[model samples]
Target: MSQIAKTKLTQTQLDAHWMAYTGNRQFKQDPRLIASAEGHYYTDIDGRRIFDGLSGLWTCGLGHSVPSINEAVAKQIKTLDYSPAFQFGHEKSFLLAEKITEFMPAPLNRIFFTGSGSESVDTALKIARAYWRKKGKGTKTKFIGRAKGYHGAGVSGFSVGGIPANRTLYGQGLESYHLPHTQVPGTEFSKGMPEKGKERAEELLNLINMHDASNIAAVIVEPMSGSGGVIVPPVGYLQRLRQICDEHDILLIFDEVITGFGRMGAKTGAEAFGVTPDIITLAKQVTNGAIPMGAVAFKQEIYDTFMETGGADYMLEVPHGYTYSAHPIACAAGLASLEAITQQNLIDRVKEMSPIWEACVHQLKAASPLVTDIRNYGFASGMSIAHIDGEPAKRPFQIAMRMWEKGYYVRYGADTIQLAPPFTTEKSEMDSLINALGDTLKEQH
Candidate 1:
C-alpha cells in the first residue's frame, strides 16, 4: 500500500469515512489529515508531523510504529493469521491470557477476552449477572454506574453508562442507578485526588440502602474517569465503595479501560490506588491499539461458581462469547505490546515522570484564559475551560480546533481539554504539549 500514490486526499475522498463521536460536519470541512506516524508524532499529508497528545486514545504507550509490535503482527500473519476460538484453542491466545493474570490483583486472575473496551464492559455486566444467577441469586440483575462515566458506546455499555448525551437517545438504559460523580466545586484545579470528594462516595451507600442491595448485582466505575474528564478518585473514595460493596454482597467492577495497562502508573489502577475490585474491564493499551482487543479480569470464585453450577461435561459453561474472542492476530499484537511495556519500563516511567507532567499541566493554571480548572494523576491531566454562560462547551471546542491546526492532537469536550500522552513521551514533548495548549488558549476567546 505504501507503494501506491501518496496523493492529496481531497475532502471528497475523506468524506466517506464515517467519523466516530465527533462533529462530523465541522471535522470534515477542516480535516487534519495524518499521512504517517512515528514515536510521538503523526505526519500530515504535507509531511508536517503533529504531536500525539492522547496516545491514540490512551493506547500507544510504547509510542507509534514500534518495530517490535509491527514485526510480531507481520510474522503472525504468515504463520497463523486466523483461528476459531470456540471449542478450538490456540497457543498464543492461551499464553496471552496467562500473561494477563500475572498483572492482575491476586485471586482476581481469571480472564475473558473480547474485541474492545465496550465488549469488555458488556462482558463484565453479563458475567456479573451470570455469576449471581449461578449462585441461585437470580433476582440480582440490576447494576450501578457513576454519573459522567463512559464505558464505550456498545449496547451493554450504553445501557449501564451514565453519560446523558450518550444515553438520552437510547431511551431504555439498564435498570440502574448512579453514584454522583466526584468533581466537587471546591476541588476545582486540585492536583491529584480532590480533597473534598471522599464524602461524595457515600452516595453509593445511600443508593444501596434505598434500592435494597439484593436487587443489584454489581457497581462499575472507572477508577479515574477518562473521557468524561480525567477526574481522579478522592483519597478514600474507592476504598469506601469497596467497603460498601462488600457489606452489601454486591460485586465491584472497575472499568479500567483507561486505568489499566500502566495508565495510572502501575500495572493496574487497583494496585496504583490500593483498592481491589471483583473485576476490571480493560482494553486500549492491551494491544497498544495496534489491533483491537479487550479483556475482563475476574476473581477465581466467580469462575468457580460458573463451573460448579453447570450440569455436566456436555453442558455449556456460560452462554457468552464473540466471534473474534481470541483472534490470533490480536493475540499476537497483545503479546508483543505487553512485552514492550515491561521491557521499556513504561509503568515505572509513568511513576517517575508524573511530577514533571503535573508541573507542566499546572503552567496552564496561570493562563486562565485557557484553563478554568485542572485535574491530574499518574500520567493524565484534564483542563476545564472558562466558558460563556449559555455555551459551556464552546471555548473548549474552539481551542481544540485551534490546537488541531497548530500541529498537535489533544482531546477537548465535556467542558475541558483532556491529556493522556504516551507513557514514553519525553520532557520536551511534554513541554511542547503545554506550549501548544497555551498558544491555542491565547487564541480561544
Candidate 2:
C-alpha cells in the first residue's frame, strides 16, 4: 500500500475544503476519498480497489498516472518552472500547439491556449464575437446555444449554456438564446446516432428569424453532449447545422472539450460526425487530464482577421489570455500525452473497443426497470433514471453511491448516470465495470 493510503484524516481537514459540483453535506456524512490511481483503477484512502467507470470525469481516457506524462511534467517543472504568458514564447507550447492540429479537422490549424475548459469556452465565444467586430460587424454579438448544452461554468459559457440550474442562481448573463434540444421524442434506447432527429437542426432557422443573423456571432454545440447525458447528434444533424450557419453567415463552434482526443473513436467529434466547424474548444484528454490545459482551434481565416485588422504590428489583437495560457509544464504534459496516443494508436483502440463497450453498457436496460433511456457513442454512455417521489436526480445519486460502495466509480449528474471506460480498457474490465453498474441499478429501487 502507498503511504497516502495509511495517513488518517480528520473532520477538520475535510471541513476546511468545499467541494465543487458535489453534495457537500451528504458527502461529509459519508466521505469517499481516493488516495491514488493507476491505469484503470483507483485506490481509496482505505486501500480498496475501485474500477474507474467515468475515466476521471471523462478527462483521463488514456487512464490514470500515465508514466510518460508524469515524467514529462517532472522534467518540465525542473527545467522551466514558469514563463510570462503574455509576451513570452516557449518551444514546447509551440510544438504542442502544432501537435494538437494533427487531431483537428482541416483549416482549423490556428491554436490559442487557456487554463481550463471554462476558459476555453469563454475564449472561443470571445473570439467569435471579436472576429465579427474586426470585420466591421460589431452588431454580431448574440450567441445561440441549444437546450441541455453545457459549455462550461464561466459567465460567458454559462450565459450561452442551456442548463437551467447552472444559470438560475447567477443573474442575467450574455445576450444569448437557446435552440431546443434534439433528443427527439421516441428515440429512447437508441444505439449510436438516431435517424429521426436530423430535422431538429432546422430549428436554428427560427432563432435566426427571431434574432437576425446579423446580430448572431456564433452557434455552439457539443458534437456529442457529455455532461448533458452523453447525448449523440442524429445523422445529418451536424451537417444541417453547418449548412444553416453557412447560409446565415454565422460561425459554428464545437465544444469538443469532453469528446475530443480518443473518446469518440476518432481524434475529434467533428471527425466522428463528418462536419467541420469554424472553431473547436478542447480540454480534458488534451493532456490526458494529467495537467490542467485547454485550447481553441480556430480556422485560418479567424486568425488572419485579427492580424490583418490590427492598426499596428506591435498592438494586441484579441487582448484576451490567462496567466497560465500555455504553462510550460502543461505543454510538456500535452506533448508527451499526444505522442503516447500516436505511438500506441489509442484512437484506433477506442474505435475497435467501442462495440464491446456499447454491448456491455446497453445491458443495463434489462438490469433495471428504472432505466428510461440509454444512449451511447464510442466509449461514452449515459442512461436516464426514472424519477422517484418527483425527484429526478435522487435515483441516479443513489445508484452511483451504491456502485461506489461496490468498488466502482461512476459520475451521476442531473437525471442520469454517465460512464466512460478507459480507452485502453480490456474486455474483462469493461464487463466488470458495466456489470457492477447493472447490479447496482437493480438494487436502487
Candidate 3:
C-alpha cells in the first residue's frame, strides 16, 4: 500500500478540505472515505470492499494500483521530478506525443498538452480561433456546441458545454450557440447507437445560416455525451455534423475527454463512429487517471497554418500553454499507461466486453419504476431515473448514496446513474455489479 493510503484522516481533518462537485454539508455528515483501490475494487475507510462500477470516474481503465504505472512514476520522480514546459524540451513529452498520435485518427498528429480536460477544451477553442486568424478569417470566432454536450469546467469549456446547470452560475460565457440535444423522444432504452436524431445534426446548418457560416469558427461536441447523461450519438449524427462543418469551413472539435483512450471500444469515439474531427480534446484516461494531464490533437493543416504565419523560427507560434503542460511525471505516467493499453490490447478488450456490459446495464430497466431511460455505447451506460417530486436529480442522488451503502461505487449526475467499469474487469465482476444494482433498485422501489 502507498504511504498516502496508510495515513488515515479523521472527519474533522477531512472537513478542512472542500471537495469539488460535492455537497459539502451533506458529505461532511456522512463521509465515505476511500482508503485504497486495487484491480476493480475500492476499500473504503471501514475496510469493506466496494465494486468500482464507475472505473474511478471513468478514468482508471487499466484498474487501480497498477504496478507498471507506479514504477514509471517512481522512476520519473527519482530521475526528473520537475521541468519547465515553456521554452524548453523534454524527451518523454516528445515520445509520448508520438505515441498518442498513433491512436488518433489520421491528420490529427499535432499535440498540445494541458493540465486537465477543462484546459484541453479551452486550448482547442483558442487553437481554432488562432488558426482561423492565421488563415485570414478573423471574424470567424463563434462556437457552436450541443445542448447536452459537456466539455469541461474551464471558462471556455463552461461556455461551450451545454449543461445548463453547469453554466447557470456563470453569466453568458464565450459567444457560443448550442445545437439541440440529440436525445429525442421514443429513443429511450437505446441498446447502442439509436437510429433517431440523425437529422438533429442539421441544427448546425440552421445555426450556421442564422449566424452566417463565415462568422463561425468551430463546432465542438462529444461524439457520445458523457457528463450530461451518457446520451449516445444517433447513427450518422457525427458524420452529418462533419459534413456540415466541411461545407461551411467550420472546424469540428470532438471533446473526447471521457470517450477517448478506448472508452468507446476503439482508440477514440471518432474511430468507433468512423468520423474524424479537426481537433480532439482528451484527458481522464490518458494517464489512466493517475496524474493530472490533458491534451489536444489537431489536424496537420492547422499546425501548418500556424507555422506559415509564425514570424520567425524562435518566435512563440502559439502563445498559449499551461505552466505544467507536459509535466515530466504526467508524461511518464502517460507513457506507461499508454504502453500498457496498447500491449494489453485494451481497446479490443473493451470491444469484447461491450456486449456483456450492454446486457448488464439494460437489465436495470425492468428492475424499478424509477428507471425511465437507458442509453449505452461501448463500455459506458447511463440509466436515467424519473424525477422525484420535481427534483430531477434527487432520485439519482438517493440511488447513489444507497449504492454506496450497498458496497458499490457509481457516478450520479443530473437524473442518471452512470457505469463505466475498468477494461480489466471480469464478467463475474460485471455480474456482481449488476446484481448489486438490481438489489439497490429493488430496495428503493
Candidate 4:
C-alpha cells in the first residue's frame, strides 16, 4: 500500500466513510484514498501517482484535475453556489441546456436535469410511462430493459436493470420486463461491433408480442453494454430494435450514462449504432464528473405530450426533479466541461485513437490463463477469462487487484475485467495501462 500522510478528518472517519457499489469490509481493510488527481493519474495520500483506469467511474472524460473546469467551478461557487431549480431561472442552467441540445438529434431537443445516473434513468422511465398516459394509453405502463444492461441503482432503474445481482436483492419495482441481453459470448475477441445482434434484437419483438404492444410503455437499453462486461451490439441490432419499437408503439430509451459524450468515438451511442430513441439518459461525462449531475434527453413529442396533459403550467409536469435539478454550480461545471470537450476536440480524439484501442483489445487474445474473449468498441473494452467453477469473476478480480497494487487501477466483476480509459487519455498512458494489464495477466501463476 502507498504510504498516505495522516490528513485532517471530520467525525466521518473510516467507520463513517461508507462507499457505494464497493466491497465495504474489504475496502475498509485497505482503503485507497486519493488526495488529488491530474491528467490521467491520481495522487495517493502519500502522493504516489496511480494510473486512472476507470476514468473516475467512467465520468472524467477530460481526465482529472482539469484546470479550466476547476477555474470555472471556482468562479461559479463565489458567484451563485445554489439556486432554486423548481420555479426559478438561472442563466448557467439555460446555457448548459442549450449546449446539450446542440448535440442531440432534432426532436430530442428537450433536457431535464437530475442528480446522478440513477436519477436520469428513473426520470426516463417516468417520462416514458407518463408519455403513454398523456396519450390516453394509460395501460401502457410496463418497461423493458435487457439482461446484463445496467441503467443505474435507483429503485426504478434497478427494476429494469438486467444485472441479477443488482436487482434480485431489491424486491419489486415499477412492474418491469427485461429483453434478452445482447452479449454474443460466441463473438468474444471480436473487433468493433459484434457480428451477431439481429437475433438478440428479435428478443425485444418477442417480449412485445408476448406482453402485447399496448401494455409495453418503453424499451430501455444501453446501445453498447458497458457495465455488464462491455457487451457490444451486433450488426443490424439497434436498427432492428428501432423497427420493433416503432411497430409496437414502444418508447425506446438509450441509457447512455456510460456511452455518452465521446467515450464511444461517436458523440453518442445513438449516433454510433445509427439507432435513434425517444429518450436518452446521460450522466458521468456530462460535467466531466466535476459535479454530480445527470440529464434525460427526450423527444419534443414526449415533452409536448406532458405539456398538453391536464395540468397547470406552474405545476410539476411529472411531480419529479431533484432539489438540485438544474443546479447552478452543476450547470457551470457542465458548461465548462462541454466547452473543454468541444475545444479540445475530444470526440474526434476518440476516433483517432480507436484503431490503436481496438488493436490493443484484440492483442489480449493470447493473454494467459487464456483469455476466452475480448469485447471492445472505441475506447472501452472487457476481457473474459475462463473460471475454475464456483470462482466466477475471481481471476479478473485478482488481476485488477494486482494491477492496482502495482500502480494501476481497473474494474473487475462478472467474470470480465473492464477497461475504460478517459476519452482524453494520452496514448502513452493507454500503452502503460494496457502494459500493466498484460503484465498482471502474464505474471499471474
Q: Rank the candidates by lDDT, best first.
A: 2, 3, 1, 4
lDDT of 3 by residue, 116-231 (tens): 99999999999999998898999999999989788888889889888888999989789999999999998999899998989999888889889999999999999999898899
**Mind giving the per-residue lDDT tens digits that candidate 2 earns over 1-445?**
4332345666687778899888888887677888899999999888899999999989998899999999999999999999999987989999999999999998999999999999999999999989998999999999999889999989998898988878999999999999888898889999999987999899999999999999999999999989989999999999999999999999999999999988999999999999999999999999999989999999999999999988798899878999999999999999999999999999999999898888988898999889999999999999999998788899899999889889999999899999998889999988888888888877775
lDDT by residue for model 4 (306-339), tens: 7887487787777788999988888988999999
- Top lDDT model: 2
**Segments of candidate 4 deviating more than 4 angstroms:** 1-12, 310-312
Model 2's C-alpha root-mean-square deviation from the true structure amounts to 2.1
Worst 10 residues of 1 by lDDT: 1-10
Task: Work out the TM-score per prediction.
Answer: 0.96, 0.98, 0.97, 0.96
> What TM-score quantifies how close candidate 4 is to the native fold?
0.96
Q: How many residue pairs clash in model 2? A: 0
Give the range of the ten consecutive residues with the poorest summed lDDT in model 3.
Answer: 1-10
RMSD of each: 2.6, 2.1, 2.6, 1.9
| Order by TM-score, highest first | 2, 3, 1, 4
lDDT over C-alpha atoms for residue 124 of model 3: 95
| Tens-place lDDT digits, model 1, residues 96-200 | 998898778998889999999999999999999988888888899999998999988987787777788799987886788888999887897788888788998
Candidate 2: Cα lDDT at 343: 95
